[model samples]
Target: MTKEWMNWYRETLLIDAHNDVVSKMKDGGLDFCQRQSATHSDLPRLLEAGVNLQVLALFAPPDSNKSVTLQRILSYAEYALDCVDRDPRLHLVLTKRDLEALSPAEGKLGVILGVEGGDCVGEELWILRLLYRLGVRLLTITWSNRNALADGIWEKDTRGGLTSFGKEVIKEMEALGMIIDVSHLAPAGFWDIAEVAAGPFIASHSNAAAVCPHPRNLSDEQIRCVADRGGVVGVNFYGPHLTEFGSASIDDIIRHIEHLWNVAGEDHVGLGTDYDGMDIVPRELEDVTCLPRLVEKLRQRGHSESRLEKFMGGNFLRVFKTVLPD
Candidate 1:
């Protein structure tokens, strides 16, 4: 890596828009404070990668009982809160001011809770309010399955948009200053969100289907729409999303970033590694500690220091300032 790239990375506040480490932490009875080979992230690995902020997803798997699933999510939130309380190095950021006060120089890592599926809310707006009270700042409308709020990517046959309840939920979330994430919402639902969102939204962990033809990936038009709405599209690093082939490398990731940049503009693109959520990752970027390797490659591609800074995290920071509650 060039000295310029190294210095820029060191000075900038790098953030990953999405990570599923908390799920693994809870499922395996693992501790976030200790390094484990079982997951793609740990506290030490985050520090090593210079990650100033991370959004930990609170995901609930599909099951028969919605109440039980929500209870499990609550347990996860408690675990995350307990972790933050015990670790001086970790800070849970609930508002814009908290994020602004984060000090990487002091070795503090800013953590934000994001609910990956609105199904966890269980058709109750009050439950959504409860999650906000519990410190969840980002909410994905759906997660590859139909929910009371809307359809996910896999529910294409329905071609349904947000339900009546979904519209109310969006308005309420916006009023509460909670960010609406569109990563797994269906194509019709994506447009529905665009029509209703008064402020920016994000695709926390998605890639360009134009680059890799996965149904899970966003189309070029979707990427452009995200940028047009003054939001950010975090380039996903999962192998299947990065390429048609099962295996992907850092170069494939770079290709997605390049395509996103070309379509979404530099200010609207960011990184959302989706670590621990995927079974396969790019060989070079096997874990959080290898983030710098991608930076080095971007430098080799001649991305200016300013552009690189935005891609690293500035874009999301800007959105946070705009959308986070004062």
Candidate 2:
């Protein structure tokens, strides 16, 4: 490939680590949920952007009662895949072979399911097994509220971090080959996970707390812990997590990428555009189609083409390769 074509390919190989497309699609309910032209991430946009791997999140807020939430999220995931099945051009990856089968030649976009919080399990181990069986590969222990598993960073009590139940949950996920996600976990909760998590894991959609100071973001120590553990951190697009100053811009986004690539190293840093979850995106890097511009910025900064490829989607794919069961 020519240098120009190589740059084009490098810029577009995105693996958006967290997206609420399914949850948003469910807002319209079963009957009226077919059209995705309404959201930021529809099948067409992802393909148009050449997004190679899409992490579709089964996101439920803290209050979603157990039995009801899991059913809804799983149902939403199934429905999302249903759309892909109907489209002959779309490819939804569920196995190692399916991942290998995809190429830019065969509609590069590949969908993977992730649960954004453990509250949906509702103290039921069966739910974890079931969700995994149903194709959930990444599971977060908590959202912004305390749960049977762990305290969220936003939990008011903050008295406890990971409860006794949380450890079991982590172990269960480990044995099942599911990636433990620490994005919204409390500080102590993060440590508990870092200590006992038997396999590779990640903070799917978070930024450096040292830069942003938001409870939702990870501290420098937290970033280091994840990196040292051979894990990756997908720096979030949300401005609140990206900065303590004023409104955010593309520069803020690049700087965070620079900082994360510096601190976490290029192998351990990637993108988790919380596109549908946040009201705003970084300037210039607005939607799925705009992601290529980021690669240009990285190139202008003198990032090698190969390292930039890892940042785009290679890092996340590497983690998935480790966590996905044979």
Candidate 3:
């Protein structure tokens, strides 16, 4: 890597919008504080990546019992909290003030909690508030199946959008200053969020459907809606999302970014490396430590420093400060 890129990587407020570290650790009985080679995230690796802020997704399987899922997720949250408490290099970011005070240069990894599916809240809106109190500032309305709020990509055949409860959830989330994540929601549900949401909402870990044509990927129009609403579209690094084939390389990732930058504009693009959440990753980006290499590649591709900064973390940081409550 170039010295200039290394300096920028260390100095910039690098934010990864989505990662499934918590769920992976819980399922695999892994330790977050140790150097884990089998997984994509660990305290030491994240810190070494110079990750200023990382959103660790707390996901429950869609078919699981809602109450049980919530309890398990809470336990996972507690474990993560305990880990943070024991380690001085880790900080759990619960408020906008915490985010504002973050200085990655100080070597602390500011961690944010995101729920991958709203199913954990069951049919009760109050449950959403309860999760918010527990430090989950971002909520993905669905996973790959139908839920109380809306249908996921798997339910696209219904062409259904958000239900009455889904609209209510969006309203309450906005009032509470929690970010509405539309990553797994079906296209119809995505449009529903775009229409009902008065403020910005993000596709926390989606790529360009126009490029890869995956059901999980966003179309050009959807990308524009996100940008138009001043929300960021975090680019997912999973190979399946990046290409028609199952395998992908760094060029494929750059291709998605180039397309997203065109469709959504520079201000709305950011990284959402779905690390530990996917089985396959681009060869060039094997783990979090390879993030700087991607930056260098983007630079070589002719992205200006300012645009690179936005794509790297500035865009997501802007949304976080706006949506995260005090």
Candidate 4:
């Protein structure tokens, strides 16, 4: 890396809104603190990439029974906390103040715990509260399947939106100051959230469907809704979401980023990466350590320093500042 590039990266408050390293760890993968060749991210590489904050997702397969899912989530949450507790370089971010204090230059990696699916929540409001108390500051309502809360992208043909319980969950989440993620939610459910959510929400790890036409990617209208609410759409690094052709590359990622920027405006775009959660990634962005290359490419594509900052982490920081607890 160039000296100038290193300086720019260190000075920027880089944040990745979604990563599934915890799930990988749950499945006998390497710990986040260790460097690994088997997964997309780890602490060593994240530090090398100057990632100031990383939101680690607690996800279970959608087909698991509710009780089993809940158990798995709890275990993941515990493991996440343990990982942070054991590492001096990592800090658990639980409030807006914690987020505001993050600085990549200070060599600290802020960690935000998030639940990636609501099936584990079942029909309970208290469980949601418990998750908040346990320091989970974000929740993705569904995971490409129907749940007590709502239908996911795979169930779009059913025209299902938020169930009554799902509406209540949204309200409670807002009351608790937790970020509601709409990534895998079906179109009906996505609109339902736009109608019920009184604050900005995030499509944490989704791309623009208008660019790639994947079911998991958001449509132009969905992107506009998120931007209109002063929310942000995180560009997923998963290849299928980036291209209709064979394998993707960093340029494919840029294509989706440009599309999201045009549709959602500059301030609404950010990176989600979804590392360790996907089977394949763009060749240039194979791991977290390659983040600087992506930034360099964006810079080469004529993105100004200020716009680069927003796309890197500033925009997401603004939303977190607004949505997170005091």
Index of the highest-lDDT prediction: 4
Count clashes in each candidate, considering only residues at least 3 apart in sequence or on different chains. Answer: 0, 1, 0, 0
> What is the Cα-based TM-score of model 1?
0.98
| Global lDDT scores for all candidate models | 0.90, 0.78, 0.90, 0.92
lDDT of candidate 4 over 1-326, digit per residue (tens): 68987798789989899999997876784677888888888888888889999999999997557989999999999989998899999999999899878976887899999999999999999999999999999999999999999999899999999999999999999999999999999999999999999999999999988889899999999999999999999998898898997479999999999999999999999999999899888898878989999999998889998998999999999999999999
Per-residue lDDT of model 2, residues 1-326, tens digit only: 35785556744466878887777767755321233555666666777767778888888666646777777777877876676667766566666676666565346567788888888888888888988887787787888888889888877355567888888889998888888899888888899888888776799999886677788887788888888888899977887878775468878888888888878888999988888788767677677677767777778888997898888888888887787776
Worst 10 residues of 1 by lDDT: 99-108
Report the C-alpha displacement of residue 38, candidate 3, in angstroms. Answer: 1.6
Work out the TM-score per prediction: 0.98, 0.92, 0.98, 0.98
Candidate 2 wrong stretches, greater than 4 Å: 1-7, 10-12, 29-37, 156-159
- Number of the candidate with higher TM-score, 2 or 4: 4
Worst 10 residues of 3 by lDDT: 60-69
Error of 1 at 30 (Å): 0.7
lDDT of model 4 at position 6: 76
Ranked by lDDT, top first: 4, 1, 3, 2
Model 1 stretches with alpha carbons more than 4 Å out: 2-4
